[model samples]
Target: MNALAAQALISARRALHQRGELAVRVAFYAIILVIFSALWSAAAGANGGSISGYDAHSLLWYVAAAEGSVIATKPRMIESIGWDISSGAIVTEMLRPASVVGLRLAAELGEALVRLVCSLAVGGVIVWLYVGQPPSAAGIALFVPASFLAVGCNLAAQHAFAGAAFWLRDARSTWFLYQKLVFLLGGMLLPLEFLPTALADVARALPFASMAYVPARLASGHVEPWLLLVQAAWLAGLLACAGGVFWAGERRLEVVGG
Candidate 1:
């Protein structure tokens, strides 16, 4: 545990050292939010006071929450794992007195924490400019835990997918597929409430919804304890699945040369 904390701090400092890149990423976040705000405003105007359950203002906020969640965790774990496998770095990591998966997860959590702050800061500015108000304090408080759990859920899913690199020698295809699933079913571009009832129910049953939709909804003042409970369940299941994959992948690991 102590070693994991130290690794997390090291990763956080590494992210801090990449401040220039983070600044550029934050700029892109602001631009995307602005574009979404305009599109939502036009749609709301065309449809009347509100489109679905969200007014223009609340819709923008919802989107901000959703986009912020997306930006916060960029799924770099897959690429990192793939690289470690292909480059034989996993062997070196295995020698360390720590669980490789746990260490990487802690590091990713550190990176995600830093990204979440930067994204939220940029998102907060855009929300103020376009929506003119902050999310409810109570809502933000509730969202913090859910969002953290969402991060863990995301890591588990990514680790499970990335474990394929041990066999495929590359996990880019898996990552791409997962990205599309998250974009379409995780409510990155639109709230699940806006989806057809049947479609929304299907998506809700999947892990993707727990990452983006549930957290965003909670942040937008939609309190649902059942959603949080479901997210926790998903987290536990995903973690177990990840651990199983890790064990299998490690067993299959073979290095051809130094």
Candidate 2:
């Protein structure tokens, strides 16, 4: 446990050391928030009122929350797993006493914490500057846990996708497609409430929604305590699936060359 914690801290420190990368991502986060605020404002005007119960202010807050979740999520675990599997570097870790998935997840959590802070800072500032009202106290309380679970869910999902490297030479394309699905269906760019009723229901049923949509919804004052249960269930399921994939993959793993 202590070793895992140490590894997490080291990984987080390493992630924070990439200050240039963080700055660029923060800049992009601000840009996207501004652009979406403008677009949603226009859409609200055309609709003659709020769209799906979201006025311009709430909509901007929604965008900020959604974008902040994405910014906070670091999906590098997929690429790292895929590369390790392909290069046979994972074999070394497999021989260790600690579980590879556990270590990687711990590390990812550390790295994600740093990004989450940076993202929320940027998004919160923008929301404050534009909307001028703080999110509901209850909403903030609920959102923090939901957002953390969302990050964990994403990491588990990516690890599962990374396991595909055992069968496919590279899993980058799968990861890419999965990410796009999250971006679209998970309410990263647009809230699920704005979607057609059927589509929104489907999104809610899927784990992707738990990743971004649920947290954003909570932050926007949609108080649904049940959503946290849904997120927890999805996170558990994803972890089980990912664990199974890695367990099976490791048993059949082979290294051909030095």
Candidate 3:
């Protein structure tokens, strides 16, 4: 890769490593897992039987995989774009030799990878202690491709949202709304299978499913291999659409005074 891309990756990695907020973010994920584990265990016991076809082990594994995927695909792009706009840093960045989108993409990917590692380590421990080990090695191997596609789709969706900063002076509200919708519709907290048939159909059709639901479902062995290919296709389509949005935004771009 060129020096610009290399520098972007270095800078992104450094930013995530040195940021004081890293601890807080890790703690947040751990706390969430603990809370959910307690709640799920209580409910499972009360039900006097399996809860939603999930034993404690399966439920915990699903939680770990789902949370890991979320951390892996967070919308750091929106935050970066907002900061650049508000501080008038876009002008300086635009003058650099690197492509702004390319640099941001590299940087955000680095950050996401860092967060994923931390989340998996911390979350994995929590799940192990409370629930037990994950599924067999084969199951984990099957999840690999789906997990990568999920992360890719997440990055594309976030960048697409961030591209809106080109026109809007303040995109924070939109960003917040998008995050909420993604978490809910993507089935981060509950499997989409639990949704009504019509709702589940719509959710599956949207790119959101490729973010968390599909990967988690695959990890849980709930999804068929044929459906895995469908998920990959959806991810590919979304990435293309996101690229088009980025190009269009760049074409119309004019950096306004902060």
Q: Compare the candidates by TM-score and give the number of the best one.
A: 2
lDDT on C-alpha atoms for all candidate structures: 0.79, 0.82, 0.71
Query: Rank by TM-score, descending?
Result: 2, 1, 3
Show where candidate 1 strays beyond 4 Å: 254-258
Q: Which candidate achieves the best lDDT against the true structure?
A: 2
Position 67, candidate 2: lDDT: 77
Q: Once superposed on the true structure, which residue ranges of model 3 sit more than 4 Å away at CA?
A: 3-8, 73-79, 83-88, 226-228, 254-258
Error of 1 at 31 (Å): 1.1
TM per candidate: 0.92, 0.93, 0.85
Candidate 3 positional error at 153, Å: 1.5
* Pairwise TM-score winner, candidates 1 and 3: 1
